[model samples]
Target chain A: MITITGLSKSFQTPYGKVDALKNINLEIKQGDIFGVIGFSGAGKSTLIRCLNRLEEPDSGIIRIGEHEITSLNKSQLREVRKRIGMIFQHFNLFDSKTVFGNVAFPLEVAGLSKRQIKNRVEQLLELVELTDKTNAYPAQLSGGQKQRVGIARALANNPEVLLSDEATSALDPKTTYAILELLRNINRKLNLTIVLITHEMDVLRRICNNVAVIEDGEITEMGPVQELFLNPRTDTTRLFVQSDQDLQLNNYSI
Target chain B: MADDLLPLLIVALSETVYMVLLSTIMALALGLPLGITLVVTSKGHISEFSGLNNVLGTVVNIFRSFPFIILIVVLLPLSRFLVGTTLGSTAAVVPLAIGSAPFLARIIENSLKEVDKGKIEAALAMGAKSITTIWKVLIPEALPSLVRGITLAVITITGFTATAGAIGAGGLGSLAIRFGYMRYRDDVLFATVIVLVIMVQLVQWGGNFIAHRLESKHHIGM
Candidate 1:
């Protein structure tokens, strides 16, 4: 379980200090797929980044299980980071390394021996269904394939929590669905807690058990996915629900 | 006559080879870490050690701006101290290395800086420390650029070595300068230029081939 309280993040701009997240309080149950939805610069990314301490909060407490995030030192942060794996919008696979090597990287950093790394990499590659592309570089893979590799890499070290920052934003709609299916499968199979941030509500609709709407760095609404969709409190939430409503209403041809 | 010319050309080529290889090795040894330092100390890098970055930046600029010939002469005392002599090919190795080291450092710094910040962030988010991130991610990601930079440095140092030859360092450059320029032997100068061009082409071609081969081309579905 993850609990975040009074989470706020601000970055200095030429104009002044710009707030990315403000007083973001949330609780994600174990094995829950929680989604943070927002428009551009809405603090969705920042709020999610706080989960892994990727973007440090100005003031707040983030607890993953019993451990508090703000209290971790450099070494302690790494320990926390290892448990909270993340995937990116661009997939961010290492270009120089093969798919297998990319997956093995975290294991190697954790001081796993060559044999251990090899076996783990093999298992990861098989899981991602990229066993054949184990020797291929990131450039050789398609967009969907790249995200799969990202998933395999994220799953390395058996992280209990996975933070996906717009993991499907770079892909086409079709590819996005495929990747989402893969993520859902991983979550179900591994019972991993997932905190996904995206501007697209469909991403949340697809796999998230719980959803949160963020605006100007604060959580404006939060609840179960279907519940939030049925009753949206904020204008942003209304917009998302309305869009999905339009799509659904259009399809029914009533 | 052709036989005599072959022996001389071959021996001269050998010296050019020696100087380029020797100085390039030294450049890499000193420059790679210096380059890594420049990246880490920059504004957005892991450490962002502004003060240390400034010191490194100033040191790099100082060496970079120093004219190699004058720097050679200025370094004469130090060279004399290190090698017990400050004249000839061996002495020339010292300055040649020093001259090229900064060039390489700057090149490496530029290459490493271009390694997408996201990759480094991804590694860091994985609980890897700065050193581990560098080893497992930064260095590997910048491998192609680093290789290209080293190749350019090698070729540039080849030119620098020829100039240093004027110092009696004794190489094809020295030979070209002594017999070709100073002695007014146009044949030897023409020959040196031709050899240098061929050597550069070879290095450029080889470096490019390796960089391309090292790159991962995106084929998403495959």
Candidate 2:
């Protein structure tokens, strides 16, 4: 389980200090696929990044499975980070590395023996179903394949929580559906808690059990995915639901 | 006359190769760490020590701005101190290396900076130490660019060797000036120029080959 309290972060731009995240609070239960939905600049990215302390919160207490993440020193933070895997929208698999190498990277960092790394990486490739593309570089793979590699790499450490920062935003709809299915399968198989942030309500509808609606820098609505989709409270949540429905209608017409 | 010129040309070509190779090694040795330091210390980087970044930047700029001809003259004493002489191909290496180190550092800095920020963040997210990220991620990703930059540095240093040769550093350049131009032997000068050009072309071709081989083949529509 992960708990965040009074989380706030701001950036100093030339224009002046701009608050990217307000005093936010959230609790993501274990084995739950929690999704945060917001438009661009809604601070969802900042909120997800802050969970890993990727963007350090100005003031907050973040506790992940008994570890007080906000209080840990640099080395301690790294140890904590190992248990919290994060994936990016761009599928940040190392371009210079083959799929095998990319998946083996975290194991190498964790100081696993070469034999252990090989076995584990092979297992991960099997999990991601990219066994045949093991020798191919990231550039050779399609977007879906690259994201699979990213997922495999993220899971290498057997992280308790997987953070997906708009992981499917770059994929086409079909690929997005496929990737979401993969994530849902991984969540069930590993019972790993997943915290994903996206602007797409279809993503929430597809995989997420719980959803939060963030507008500007604040959460305006929070509930189960179905409840929120059926009865959106705030204007931002309504806007997102309306748009998602419009997209579906347009797709059906096409 | 042809026999005499052949031996002289052979010796000169060997000298140029010796000086260029050694100095290039020296430049890489000194400049690579300096370049990494520059990038890692800059704003919002892994280390992000602005003070060190500013000081190092100023120092590199100071060295980079010096005219190569004057730089050699200025470093004559240091070269003599380090190599026990300021003449010949071996002694020329000290000044040559110093002259090119800052230039290579800038090239390396640019190459390293071009590495995707997202990649570094991914490495960090995976619990990689900064050193690990630098060695395993940044270096590997930027390798092709780094090779190209080093090739440019080598080619630039090769040109500087001619200027160094004018000051008693024995090489094709010195031979061209001393035995070829001074003696009005257009044939010797022409031969040296041809050798120099071929050497440069070979370096360029080799650099490109290695870089191309190292590059990951990207499929269309990425």
Candidate 3:
């Protein structure tokens, strides 16, 4: 459902030019939960941002469904963006808007009538189990509930692809598990193509079927999650798998 | 003499209100868009146009740095051209609005800047156009602060109105100078000062009330 070829991005810092993503290529199948795992500064964030053209790549080709996202003009890209929903680590909700207002934002942008927007927003809220909090503002909700609003808002347009940018990073482990479960349920229910990036091995293990290890702007390992977990190839992948095991051991000891 | 004082004070107070209120409306009309433009066109913003941003910034700065008294003199012809005379409270509004507009713009820019960048990115990611984001996200999020800033602008313009009275614009300031200083009627000056204080207090109180109400609704989430 999504394909990228020779993607590259660099930032000109005061010190010098630093490569954020260097010649990255990947493919994600429809209805698959694809995960990119990397440490901070490993460029995973940049990689996912490029998928939606939120962060413009210095050079690359990004294809989502039939649209070549990188080649689209401003207006064309905006039209295509309606089909690609993105959620952030911070939830990025509008503080001024209530849950219903937040979820209805995309519908409003899509130019739906007031009745259609209310109906669609209600449906989306039910999907994310936030129906009870419709009129509540984001600050009034807990972290998990806010994330639920984010999920509902992301799904408002019935997007074909859902991009999660460390969406659960800010939550506690218990909350993270529940949010991931929600994402899994969403993926299954909608058959949506999911692309997520994270620094946590547990996050990938919990939901991602296919995982890629990124290091210093390059993908060092890519394969099925189980295969990579059982027989890791690179030092970074091995460290990640080892850490996941260590976490399990600590849980057992506790 | 004492019987005539009440009517004269009433007229002067009304003129002060007229000049302040009209100029404020004009300032808002001119300044809001200028402020939005300053924010939207800056480097790395939604529609990043650094050249236009710098030029506009410089113009706003230049206008802002001019003293109000100098601004009145400098804008004399504009006031005359705009209102057909440069001596009355109506003519004074031309310089007053022009003087306050850039100051209000800076305040508005600061308030808008206080909105979270992440919220803007979220708006863009959802396929919202720049105009939609500005109207829906930036302006709404900064509304409370904008109110507070406008309160300050209105108070500043009120002070300018008094100064405008010095030159012949009929208001409390001219009333004080003409009667209290020239005619040696300290009672007239005292009355004018009291009225001006009451007006400013009402403006501040009203601004705070509205801003607090908005903040309760919008900022509780932050």
Could you say which candidate leads in lDDT?
3
lDDT per residue as tens, model 1, A110-159 = 88999999999999888889898888888778899999999999999999
Q: Candidates' TM-scores? A: 0.95, 0.98, 0.98
Give the 10-residue window scoring lowest on summed lDDT in candidate 3 chain A.
A130-139
lDDT of 3 by residue, B82-186 (tens): 899999899999999999999999999999988888899999999999999999989988999999999999999999999999998889998999998899998
Model 1 - which docking category?
A: medium
iRMS values in order, in angstroms? Answer: 3.0, 2.3, 2.1
Q: Between 1 and 2, whose TM-score is larger?
A: 2
lDDT of 2: 0.92
Question: Could you tell me how far off, in angstroms, the CA of residue A93 lies in candidate 1 after the best superposition?
Answer: 0.5
Best by DockQ: 3
User: Which tens-of-lDDT digit does each residue in A1-254 have in candidate 3?
Assistant: 89999999999999999999999999999999999999999999999999988899999899999999999999998898888999999999998888898998888898999999999988998988888889988888999999999998988898999999999999999999999999999999999999999999999999999998999999999989999899999999999899989989999999
lDDT of 2 at A174: 97
lDDT of 1 by residue, B160-222 (tens): 888887886777888788778887877777877888789999999999988776663432334
List the DockQ of the predictions in order: 0.57, 0.61, 0.63
Per-prediction TM-score, chain B alone: 0.93, 0.96, 0.97
